[model samples]
Target: MELKTIEELNQIGFEKIGEWKINKRGALDYEITTDKTTEVLYSFVKVDNQKEEIIYIGKTIRTIINRLNGYKKPGNSQFTNIRINKEILNLLKSDLNVNIYLFKCNDVITYKSHNINLAAGLEDTLIKYFKPKYNLHGNQRIIDDVELSENLIKLTNDMNDDKNCQNHYLIEKTTTVSNLEGKINLGNVPFSFLPEYGEIINIYLGDIVLQANFINGNNNGGNNPRINCVAIGNWLRENGINVNDNFYIKICNNNSFYFSINKIY
Candidate 1:
């Protein structure tokens, strides 16, 4: 059987008394076909952030539409068999592409009572086939939306390796930097672990990214030289982070003494 679209399902009536679906929204928005309604409910179905993976699959027996609609809300956390985080739900409704592929049968099966068995089989078949992330019975391949670069992963692993890093100290703190006249006062940071001047570092302000250069200054007042990088200061301003916005810094590993700066919020 082929999965038919909403328009196609309307044109070609179902011959079997089993389940039918009209694609509504998200990755897989399906419902037990009924006499009324065109098709689809965003609930009882969800797609991952990238819309490349189907995250959840569900079935409703009586009052299928109501059951499907219940998934839209986070009630007493009792409606859904699997946990659906608020963030995940928001992503599903926002970015997930909805489509329905009706697997209509040849033989006609009309009434809802008879369609129960058929719906069960169809739901099970889809759950097993897709192995949706939210499914508890089928292929429980749960994967989140966190994306990590290979180099970042390796750097973190290296930081945690005792053999490579002996008595390594990790500092994760929120700090605000000073940018005055294209000069950045890095403050009382452990600059001993940092590389020489002219090297590059990364700075992220929300979605905006920037590459910053480290230029040495004269330490005439018994303090370490401040970094004079105009590009980063300008980039921060461009990204709506002025000279004193709180930025979160994460050092994947001091093995390279490289730290990545991220915008808070």
Candidate 2:
């Protein structure tokens, strides 16, 4: 069935549930409700003779249900509506149970730009932590290992070219770089550095080493760089890196490193 509004979703009921942070004002706001009004829930559908499987999970506050309804429009929605994708639709339709949950709030909330970012981050973190099958985007595994080795080598070679360069050493097992091969088609390298040291660095396809830089560090004074990390993660996921793997990172005064694949989501 097609979901139109928050009320409709509530009326249909749900089988599983989750929570979301909503901004009551223009700042970061939290709604604590014992009534499950603050959470988004899910339901499942059984395909063929298989058991029920969750298809969607979401929440709404105020009249924003109109936005959900608008998803029916072609090419305008962020998610591919099952109605339009016959393959996915059939898969869900054949499911025995479809789980869905709704979070409703009486008061309207206004979100600031930064607060939106925070909410997004919170949502992403929760989805990643939960590993919900319906949350496909959250299941991405960051490409580390080989990519990290390659970037470290490239960086080492680059720095080595400088005659005045001092000793450069990467923190053992702390350096991690994402491999980007298929996603990007054109321009330059896309790389993202996590400032907390040892976080996986995402490098995009077609990105060069010159574009990579630390997110919140000194950058050691050099030209800014950008690399594709999403592509790397996609490649790794396709190749066998599990999304739930335990990522370890290490950083030294001059270098960084990452090690091991612990899990896949």
What lDDT score is found at residue 219 in candidate 2?
Answer: 28
What lDDT tens digits, residue by residue, belong to model 1 across residues 1-265? 4432233333443222222232454422333455332211122333345334445544332243444433343233122321444434455456554332333333434464432234333444555565666554356421111111212111222232335433223444333455523454544556433322323343333334334444334222112334444554565556565544543443322212222245322
Off by over 4 Å in 2: 1-52, 58-64, 71-73, 76-79, 82-88, 104-122, 141-265
Per-residue error (Å), model 2, residue 16: 7.7
TM-score of each: 0.30, 0.27
**Whole-model lDDT, model 2:** 0.30
For candidate 1, the per-residue lDDT at 182 reads: 41
